[model samples]
Target: MKIAITADIHLKQSKDEAPERYNALINIIKKIKDEKIDKLIIAGDLFDKEAKNYNIFDEFVKINNDITFYVIPGNHDVGLNQKYFTANNLQIFNSAQVLSFNNNAIKIFLIPYSADNSMGEVLAQNEQQLPEKWVLLGHGDYITGQSTPNPYEPGIYMLLTRHDIETYNPVKVILGHIHKREIFGKVHYVGSPCGLDITETGKRYFTIVDTNSGEVTSNKILTDILYYNENLIMLPVEDEFGYIEQQIQKMIKGWSLSDDELTKVRLRLKINGYTSDLKKLQSIVNDALKNFTFYNDKEPDLTEVNVLKDNERIQIIELVKEAIEKNDKELGLLQLTQNDVMEQSLHIILNKA
Candidate 1:
């Protein structure tokens, strides 16, 4: 049997970002329903803060009653037991629990977020009873070389160490709280199902675990907002136009958008470096891009970008700048313009020669 898993949704009501994340959730659920996956497991952080918008979640759950959402309390919502969050097809695991499937073939250990205890502490009793093939589901920090505390809120919450993984030895360890998708051997941080914040860039995915084959895979979930913030670096080459257009085209292709999804992309393009003609560079972007919303609903400004005159002259200028940069990289010795710095650098080189 195949099970779909996701976590760190951070669903909140009465917020500016409520719709963006909420719509993504709807799309994810719809995809699950369409795939005929009856069981959907949410590792944790289904709600953000103490925003007890139970009715909002309840309505969505009722509408999609066919799929059972097995949820565990995350650090943010550890007070879940105190809330009146009632919904059909939603089993919120508030304690250390286990769910058996496929006639005792697979056991999924659900360890909810706890402030006082570690994951190994909670699963100590089940250490001996761990089935040959089992999967662990939890919500918190896993202490490892790569594992870092939640950047948004830096603190230890029910930490999991390598010892925990070695002792329990679940077939797969899926977790939430870390917004970046990370993999350290069998431990997988499922990450945020969708980008909850603008800084949380990249396409998101929900993991799939096939109990029969003991294989874990991820299926990418591309949602409403496809945000691309890029620095379009310019070159001083004669054929730089092709290079500039190529970068823009490559970004468009990376989006993997169909005709319908063309309107979903939001681009924040910042042109830097020296171009043959600044206006020409801006024109190139205009000609290439069809219909993408510029960052702040304002067109990309290229007026400040440097204009290239002569390639040979630039190379000489660069060589001198490089030599001067070795001594004063930040130009901290004095406040000097481009000409002043280059003139001073030339004078020093002449004196040395």
Candidate 2:
């Protein structure tokens, strides 16, 4: 049987709703039905925050009715008592249980999420010999060290380790918590189907597992409502503003964003040269980059630096220029621009006569 596996669906309903997320999810369901997949498995995080929307169930009813869906409640969807799901063909597993299918050919060891340290107890209590081709599906922070709650946030979560999995020894373990797709041994972290935030860069995908052969494949899906590209350009102290502009353009020339895509390019120009009017340089770059439609533009890190101070300005510039020409020499000119020396120079040049 062919089964589609995806995680971190993060569905929600709001006044200013995100249609792209819903559309991406709907498209996946369509693809599964079109391909004639037998079952759909969502590891966790089907809802964005809380499972408040009854409309999502109604929406699922409109989709394929034949395909069986197995959903494990993630941290976001774990607020209420969703022990049993009676919508469409949805099956909710809120606790640890062994789910059998295809005349016992496929066994799914479902470990639902728990905020407390009760997961260990559940595993220990339900310890039994799994089938030959059993898969472990759960939602928790699987980490050797500490758990990062989200990609951008810093918070420790209830953690599990590879050693914990080896103790159980399933053929494959599919987890849902980390937003980045990663595979460690037999455990697979199926990341979010869509880029939830700008911090989540690169393409997003879902997994298609062939239960017959044990072959897992990734299917890339486009779910980005906005495209964000952040680049840090290093330059050898150039006095010409146009040179910086040219370099910025050259660096971002590889972007193939559609005209309708909301694109944000944050150019952090770190230069170790002398230039007039830092504001004007920023204005020039901003105006030059105005062709791209970004939702929000941040103040560029315009580092027009002077390695020398006071009377030694010209001498230091010359020295910096010579060092840059060497190319072979690691002068660390870019490093100097990021430190307090550049800030001091900015104060001296911009604030003084």
Candidate 3:
């Protein structure tokens, strides 16, 4: 039997975000249908919170009636009622249980997260009774190699150790709770199906496990909503104003923005030298970007400029130059005539000329 597994869908309805979260999940389900997968397992966190919109979820289940879905409640889905999902093909595991499928071909030791009980106690009682050929699906903070308290869990729930699973020796272990896809020995944390935050900046996937051969694989999907990338560039101390502009242009051009995709880009520049027209430089950088919510952080390095053995008037000129060369690195400011502290100092020395 071929089973498709994903976790942390985090479905929520929001006015600011145009229901893309639901759409992204529908796209994944469509792909699964196209692949003719037999079963779909949502390891945990099917909703960002207790899902209040039952009608929308019912609609989602009705449209995908061909596939059976096994869902486990995550930490956020604590106290989520099975009545919210009214599909005959749906199986909700609100607590620890065993599920058998394919004429005894596969057995799943499913442990859903509970705010009331300790997961460690649940595992200890049930793991020893696990069948020889079975998969362990759970939601908790799992530590491998060595066991310790996960700083994030505090006292909300108890953690499961990888060593604990090894004793039971399940064929495969699939887990959720962590938002980044990771593999520890025989266990897998299948991450979120879509990016939940700006830091979740890479491609996402759903794992496919073949029950016969006990082999695991993944299907890569392109995310069309909410993308982010961050980069840092350095500017030399001797670069001229025009050279600085050219360098900034080069960096911006290097980023490939899709015409149809909305992406967020962050650029940080650590500048070493000086330039006179700082305000103008910011404007040029702002106008050069497209299809990006641009943000930049630029810092001027005065350590090198301060070491120059020049007169106070000449030093002021150098400082203004530094500001101009460091230009256009911050987002949102477009004024081309506003003078900074160093620029005002330059003006004072030049008698407002």
Candidate 4:
């Protein structure tokens, strides 16, 4: 049995809100159909928020009418009020009840996000007799050494630890909720199938799990999406401006940036070496501003500037004055107020300038 597992679609009808995310999901479904995938499993977070917009849900039904989909409720899906209901052939599992797919060859188990009342009781009772070659599908945090703090749930937390996998021992445990892709033991987080926000920038993809000969083989399918890669480059004064321009160009080259589209670029430059002409850097900055539509230009405060040579103290002070003249207050303060050595030096420079 070949199964395509994805999560965090966050589908909404409004184009202004999550149009890219919705389009990405549509593209993925079309790809799945072309490949003739047998089963489709969505771990959770199918909707951004639990609001009744049947029109959006109806559009989802049209796209995925052919395939059999099994989904669980995510934190966002449940929200403050538990609004769980049925839609078409899509089964939304919100409790710990074991849903058995009684087909002869493949037996699938649908496990959704559990309430406090159900999780402990269900795990305690049925921890022993899990079906063979079955898949455990749900959305929750995994209790691993790499688990980080999440603000989605205030006090209550859910985790499928390594110990839990060893105990139940399903063929494959596919899950969601964690936005980044991760593989621990036999359990796999398909991550968000589409990029939801800037924090979700990376190679977003889905997993195809093949269950044949009682063993599961997983492959990743990359999606068509836009993601940002943030970089902080430090260079000599002569190379600083050129380096910044090059970085910006690299981000925009061969990439499609739509009008009124926003892409975040965080650039920090620490100039160390001497340059005969400081004004040359301005040309590079101007070029970047003219070429890029949306970006944030952040040059280091004076404290962050590194004086490479001990004898080049006078040169450093000159650079600090130039930075102040340019209204780079953060850099100016760092240079003047950081240490007695640079403070006294910059104090005299400021007085003289």
lDDT of model number 2? 0.63
Pairs of residues clashing in candidate 2: none
- TM-score: model 3 vs. ground truth: 0.69
**RMSD, one per candidate, in order:** 7.6, 5.7, 9.9, 9.1
Enumerate residue pairs that collide in model 1. Answer: none
lDDT of 3 at 71: 91
For each candidate in the order shown, give its overall lDDT on alpha carbons. 0.75, 0.63, 0.64, 0.57
TM-score of 2: 0.73
- lDDT by residue (1-353, candidate 4, tens digit) is 56777887777646467566766666667777888974577777777774556466555654567877767777667541233333465665655545454454444556666555333345556655556656676677777677544444444445566676676666777777877777777777787876665456555678776655334444433444445534332234344566556645655552444432333332232332233334554456446656332213444323333333333654565575345446546656666422233344454643532
Give candidate 2's error at residue 120 in angstroms: 4.4
- lDDT (tens digit, per residue) of candidate 3 on 1-353: 78888888788754235365576677778888888985888888888774667567667777788988889988878766678777887888877787777755667788888765555678778766767798888887776644333333354344677667767777888877776677877878787777675555455778888777767787765465544443322222244345556665665555454444435343333333334444544454444443345323333222322122235655556566566647744412655432244344445555664
lDDT of 4: 0.57
Q: Candidate 4 has which clashing residue pairs, if any?
A: 301-330, 301-331, 302-331, 303-334, 303-335
Candidate 4 ranges with C-alpha deviation above 4 Å? 13-16, 79-87, 97-106, 117-121, 148-156, 213-225, 241-353
Q: Weakest 10 consecutive residues, lDDT, candidate 3?
A: 300-309
What is candidate 3's local distance difference test score? 0.64
- Against the true structure, whose TM-score is highest? 1
